[model samples]
Target: MLNAIDAIRIFSGDFQETKTFFVEAVGFEIGFEDEGVCVFDLAGTKLILEEVDLSEPEAAGMVGRFTGVSFATDDIKSTYKELSAKGVHFEGKPETEEWGGAMAHFKDPAGNVFTLVQYPPQN
Candidate 1:
C-alpha cells in the first residue's frame, strides 16, 4: 500500500538556476546533488529538481505551470513580504480564503508557480 510520498520532482529547463532559487531564495536545504539532479530537504518529503531538455515535447510541458505544491507558513503576510523582497514574483498579495486560511502564489525562476499557505488556527 502507498503510505507516504518520499519525494516530489519538479522538472526544470535550467536546473542550476532553479536549484539556486530553491536554495538561496526559498531557503530549502540540499539533501543531495549531482550532475542533473538536486534534491532538497523539505519538512517531510524531498523536493527534487531534475534537469530536462525543454526542446523535447514531453519535457516542454512539464515546466512553467502551477505545481500544486504549497509551502506552509505561520504568517502569510510576512512570508509574502519577505519572499517578495527577495525578488520572488507573487501573483498578488496574500488573500484570506472562505475557510479562514490564507495563501499567496509565487513563481520560481523556472516559472513554476507554488503557494505559501497559512492555515487558520485550530479550535
Candidate 2:
C-alpha cells in the first residue's frame, strides 16, 4: 500500500524564477536544480518544477497550467509576516479557514497557487 505522496510536479515556463519563488518566498528548501528542472522539499514531500517552452511555434496555442500546493505551518500569521517582509505578496491576509485552521494563500511567479495553514491549537 502507498504510505504517502512522495513528490508532486508543477509545470513552469521559467524554472529558475519559479524555484526562487518557492525557495525564498514560500520558504521551501531547494534540494536540486539541473538542466531545466528544479526541486524543492516540503516537510515530507518534494515539489518538482519542470521547464516547458511555450514560445516555440510547436508549443504555441497550448494552454499553460499551474499547480496548487498547500503547506502546513505552526503559526500562519508569523509565517505570512516573515514572507511578506521578505517581499512575498499574499493573495490575502490570513483568515480563519473552514478546515479549522488559519490560512494564507498566494501565488508563485509561475502562477502556481499555494497556501500556508496553521491548524487550530489543540485543547
Candidate 3:
C-alpha cells in the first residue's frame, strides 16, 4: 500500500526570498537544504522548493506555486488572531462559509491560497 503524500514541492523564481517568507512569515522551520532544494517543516507537513535554471514561466508550463492547503482548527478566531499577530496576510476576515464552517483565507508569498476552517459546531 502507498502512504499519503507527505511533502509538496514547487520551483521558485527566488529560492532565498521564498525560503524567508516560508520561514519567517509562515511559521515553517528549516528542515534542510541542498544545491537545488530547500525543505521546510510546518508542524507535521513538509514543503520543498526547487531551483530551476530556465525562465519564460508562461511558456515553460510552470505553476507559480502549490495548490491551496487547508488546515482545521479547534478555534478559528484564536488561530486567526495568533497567525495574524505573527504577520500572516489574510485575504479576508473569517465568516460563516456556505460549506458550514467558520473560515478564513490567506495567500502565501508565492500566490498560493490557504484556508483555515473550523467545522460547524455540534451540540
Candidate 4:
C-alpha cells in the first residue's frame, strides 16, 4: 500500500545550472550532493536532481517539462512577486482556481515547470 513520498527526481543534462537554480533562485537547501546527483531538502521529503547524458534521446526528453510539483505557500501573490524579483521567470500572474486556491507556474533553468500554490482557507 502506498503511504508517503520520500523523494522526487528531476533529470537534467545541465546539473550545475539546475542545482544553482534550486539553491539560489528557488531557495532550496542542499541536503546532499555527489558527482552526478544533488538532493534538496524540502522539509522531510527530498527533491533530487539526477544528471543525465543529453546524447541519449530518452534521457534528454526528461528535461524541460511540467514537473507536476506544486509548492504550498500562505500567499501566492507575495511568493510569486518575491521569486520574480529574484529573476525567476513565471508563466504569468497568479490566478484563482475554481477551488478558490491561487496558483502560479515558474520554470527552472532546465525549463522544468513547477507550481506555487496557495490553498483556500480551512473551515
Cα lDDT tens digits, model 1, 1-123, are 998988988888998899888888888899999999999988779998999999999999999999998899998988888888888899999999999999989998889999999999999
Candidate 3, residues 1-123, lDDT tens digits: the string is 967778876666666776787777766777999986898876777777776654675623444543566778989998899888877888888898887788898766555567888998786
Indicate the worst ten consecutive residues by lDDT in candidate 3: 57-66
Give the lDDT ranking, best first. 4, 1, 2, 3
TM-score of 2: 0.83
Clashing pairs in 1: none
Instruction: Please give the distance, in angstroms, between residue 75's alpha carbon in candidate 1 and its true position after superposition.
Output: 0.6
Cα deviation of 74 in candidate 1 (Å)?
0.6
Query: Whole-model lDDT for model 3 versus the true structure?
Result: 0.74
For candidate 2, the 10 contiguous residues with the lowest summed lDDT are 58-67
TM-score of 3: 0.73
Q: What local lDDT does model 2 show for residue 41? A: 77
| CA error at residue 97 for candidate 1, angstroms | 0.4
Per-residue accuracy of model 2 over 1-96 as CA lDDT, tens digit each? 999999998776777787788777666777888898888877789888888787875543221433456788898888898988877768899999
Q: What is the C-alpha lDDT of each candidate?
A: 0.91, 0.76, 0.74, 0.92
The residue pairs found clashing in candidate 2 are none
